[model samples]
Target: MPSLINDQLPPVRHYEAAPLTKEQLDYVDLPTIDISSFTASADPNVRSQLVAQVRSAIAKYGFFYVLNHGLSTAQTVRMFDIADVPFSDVDDDEKKKYQSRLKETGTQQGYKPRQYHHIDNGIRDQIEIYSLNHDVNKSGHPAALRPLLPEIEQFAYHNHVNVLYPILRLVELHKWEDMSESSGHTDIGSLTLLYSQPIAALQIRTKDGSWKWVKHIENAIVVNAGDAIEFLSGGLYSATIHRVVQPPADQRAYTRLGLFYFVLATEDVKLKPLNSPILQRRADIWLKERFQGAEVPTMAEWRKGRTKSDGNAELKASATNLGVEEEYLNGVLIKHYV
Candidate 1:
């Protein structure tokens, strides 16, 4: 895998980013499930054990860590190496040429410059993102990234097909409050897989309505259920609200590089709860009413609206919820905490 990367690019290690202090390492206690057996073994007992762990984790926490899902340390480090190239090497003009067309095309498929998202109190976000949709050839990307597409494609496929699919299939299967740098909100997609970064900024809201840091595990992927799954499960699976904040003083100087894969349902699929009795029996009345009408947006309309609306979030009072404001996506009200 190292040979696949350009020799000219220096290696970037996750631990080098920022080491957390003893006190800074306070992380929420969450289950860590080893999934190697489930992905490799055909044995039903092996698979069932894995499923049981996942079912319990999701039911209790809405988030958990997955170990041995097939990615390696060197391979993971190489990704950060690739990530550093766009922001550190490419010029602003060249990068902007491929700037995210989320505003127009409704697809977040290109470079998103720093401070692109608005936060509260006149603060703009400090993160830069270069998102590649499932289709790599759909549009042009930065020239520097061209040489690395093969590597990127392989990595993306590993996540989408190799890892996400099996997890999605089990049992058909079972399926945070924070206001910080990235603010408190739920992900619009079905599932989220975030690779580990040593920075201590990511936090998850607990069942008690308090936030706690998420500890970094070596070579482990942070898996969390999102809004789509919650909807599909009839709200049986909670879409945990989490956010990013500035790292401790020791880590603030280093740039934080995150690798994430968001799983979204297909465009034409109607946004309705599945007919599974296990899902339908949940007591989430709001989830039922939210999609009860024929006017519910298709995945396409909902995704496009959510992606575009997020970038242009206009802060205003919400008549419904306090301590937050409102935005809309295809007539659906999306709230952002202050």
Candidate 2:
């Protein structure tokens, strides 16, 4: 099969700003947690309260805003500055020099230019992305970014140990116009930490099935649970369904830059429900609805299948929308009916 990369790039298209719908105009904020106490306090009671708050947020919304995460505003600015070099400063030819053959590597690391179609809209989005996988330090990143690696790595490690527990290091530099961005979809990993650059283009699907804009809060990082965690939690926690859209008319000229850290479990971890008291109480009903009587696949097996499907356009297009295939290749439930 031909690779997903484009040999010929298309002209960038622009969209006119439209008025926000009633649902979009109103703001429904995500749960916000102050994690400083959780990390600082030695008392078990304080720690337990924090844990319960996190569990409640995940069980209901699958996403939250985190404050006091140790990284300062200046540190975040520096990281964004480093991220801007490749897309904004470097010439197109220089950027292409780092382009990756994702089909061959079976990974999303390295440079990917615009024209990648959105699954929901089927329109080519105007965006550029540079991905750094677990071996980013060993990988051939541009020399200009080397100085910032230590800080970035430290932040990733801290979040992994404190929140994700088991993680696969994958960071992405995403630069895109507010006019064209990602469609609503759940991430494949266990968790995702997104550092936004004061642009408010991100939105999350609410319980009422309406789209609500997620406002950009200063010094706060947006974190969301993914499919893997949802699977492990046995329907108690859901993976958030979200999308990046065009900013409102007033901010149309501003480009959106996001630093994304995707967290994955160890390869050997099974995609089965954890034996927690909360899950155990409803395991029979949840398991029946989740698996639909099919056996679950290991994390490694599921990742392989997911990457394979993503790389092949035809295969991805034909696959079942709700993940009910011949096998449970995707880590999430393969339900026949919602």
Candidate 3:
């Protein structure tokens, strides 16, 4: 038996196991779209067909990989590698400045980063992030983005405006999650851009009702949906069930320096199917469509356990006011079925 004397026993601690190796990473070859197809197609019909397909995927899978987009190959690689630089290598004061300011001003949401729980069950996903909001009125002018990360700031701007906006018509990038793998809850947004290094830990809710791995592709951008799309389609779409499971015990993983850009439908806009009128007109099929198979939990269901934490009380970010509130209509969300 171990004695109470401090000297009798050595200090020990528990550390997370290693991350999944390349062979072990989930290799997901999801559908990819060639952006040029929409732009270069002289044939109007082909462009329509492609856009229709991409839109359908967003509505249904809530996740997809895009290719042949405007981003350059060299730029992509650099984006992945830049975050790997040692902030300690920089003027120590630079990192200290970041830490001090973040601690003082709260998070990009005007709240402290320490107050909230990633999940209700005492999980600590300690990440600190800032936001870059672009003012739409200023055409040439960009948003106040990436002041600390100036290296990627230009890339973010050009992508958001030139490439992404024309295609997705997204207005502004919401507060980026200053986090790494460790999924606790989901949220309601139109779209998300999962920008990460070669971190092989993108896990998602599999179609089989099990959470499986999403193979991480270095320098590739992945997009997914949120509750807003689900609500608008009346659940015809998927908000996706994704999380960052730390690399398993043996494969210690690299620290994931990733950004999740929650894309919103320009505020005040309503999301509906192009065929919304047609779908709404057919109530029975709509009902059938919404309740296709095994039901997943709602935002409220997944969020049942979340509450505030104490370590960072100064940055208490409250949940959005019951955002994306709606009923699935004969869906599994209801209880006491008559």
Candidate 4:
């Protein structure tokens, strides 16, 4: 497995499993927000109420389910059909033609073959991904997949304007093993909108430093806050620490596929904490402590560095054994440093 980190990738290391408490193994239901009223109503008060609900969910759990998001089942299934071709149907030799060389492109937009290893798991994750960015020219995806680009681009754009504006974004297809998948980590962007298959392997870290499964709700898009949002909101909203673990024993016979649309801030935007009313009252304590002596980086620089630093063994070791941390914000427990 090739390292995502450059020279900084640590040598293979052993990880000891930490025992989980009964509470840690228990499940908690994620908040579900229905945005149908916001999209349908012309009233400003209804819109404000929707915004308030979203804000509260992000601040507390950093993860939620969005209902009535307007994307039909047929449209989403079409996307899955397109994604399935390169990952499951194409010959291995042909698929390699689209493989991404991050060193050459200086970006992560393109196909990435399986066998990329993460230190926490000390093994290759069983998944292959194809990522497409907003700018067509900048995306290194192969021309063979161009036919599907229009629908893919439209879906991404709709989510951007309707959910949030001035955001960075990517559309990705993940063909994953039914068992082992991604390790615990926070996303590098502002928000993520994921359309997952029926299999439920995704898990979110709770305030008590425990893990809980994110139930699969049919036709619902799972939305979550990410690191960029935390930076923008002055740590009032958290970037949830979450992972895709192996499915339960009974589900091992099948594979899982996920279609993810990740939303981020615009490239040139400065990521200094915002002066919002929420942060003003709290004195931005979490923001101050998290960056006590570190210099703040612009959105572009932070994102570039984050992409490079992913799967760093040393960093993973220094954090928790499972690659997660917990902090409290305004009496709500939030997970980070994954």
Instruction: Encode model 2's per-residue lDDT on 1-338: one tens digit a residue.
Output: 11112334221222222233223354666788888887688888987777777778877888888888766766555556656655665677776777766555556666777875433335666878887754446467665555546555655555555544311222221111110011566776777888745556777888877778777777777889887787777777887888777777666766677777776655666667777687788877877787777677666665555554442343233253543222244434322111
lDDT winner between candidates 1 and 4 = 1
In candidate 3, where is summed lDDT lowest over 10 consecutive residues?
A: 173-182
TM-scores, one per candidate: 0.87, 0.76, 0.60, 0.78
lDDT of 4 at 14: 19
Cα deviation at 90, candidate 3, in Å, is 8.1
Residues 1-338 of candidate 1: C-alpha lDDT, one tens digit per residue? 13444567444433345665455455899899887787689999998887788878887988899888776777787787786777777899999798887777677878877787888777888888888865566678888777777777677667766677666752232210110001778887777899988878888888877778999888899998887776666667777788887788877777788888777776555566676676666634655466443366666677777777775767677886667677655556666665
Which residue pairs collide in model 4, if any? Answer: 168-264, 179-246
Report the candidate with higher lDDT, 1 versus 3: 1
**Best-fitting candidate, scored by lDDT:** 1
Please give, for residues 195-231, the per-residue lDDT of candidate 4 as tens digits: 7466657888889878888876777888888877877
TM-score, cand. 3 vs. native: 0.60
Reference-based lDDT, residue 30, model 2: 79
Better of 2 and 4 by TM-score: 4
lDDT order, best first, reads: 1, 4, 2, 3
Residues 1-338 of candidate 3 have per-residue lDDT tens digits of: 11112343222221222244645554555666666676677787886777676777675556777666555655554444443332213343343343323333322321123333333246566554433333322112111222224444455555455445434632332222211111422444556777534546676665654556666554556877775556455656667867666665444434555654555444333334325565566534544554554344342222221112113322323344221222232242321100
User: Which ten residues in a row are the worst by lDDT in model 4?
Assistant: 173-182
Clashing pairs in 2: none
For each candidate, the alpha-carbon lDDT, in order, equals: 0.72, 0.61, 0.45, 0.61
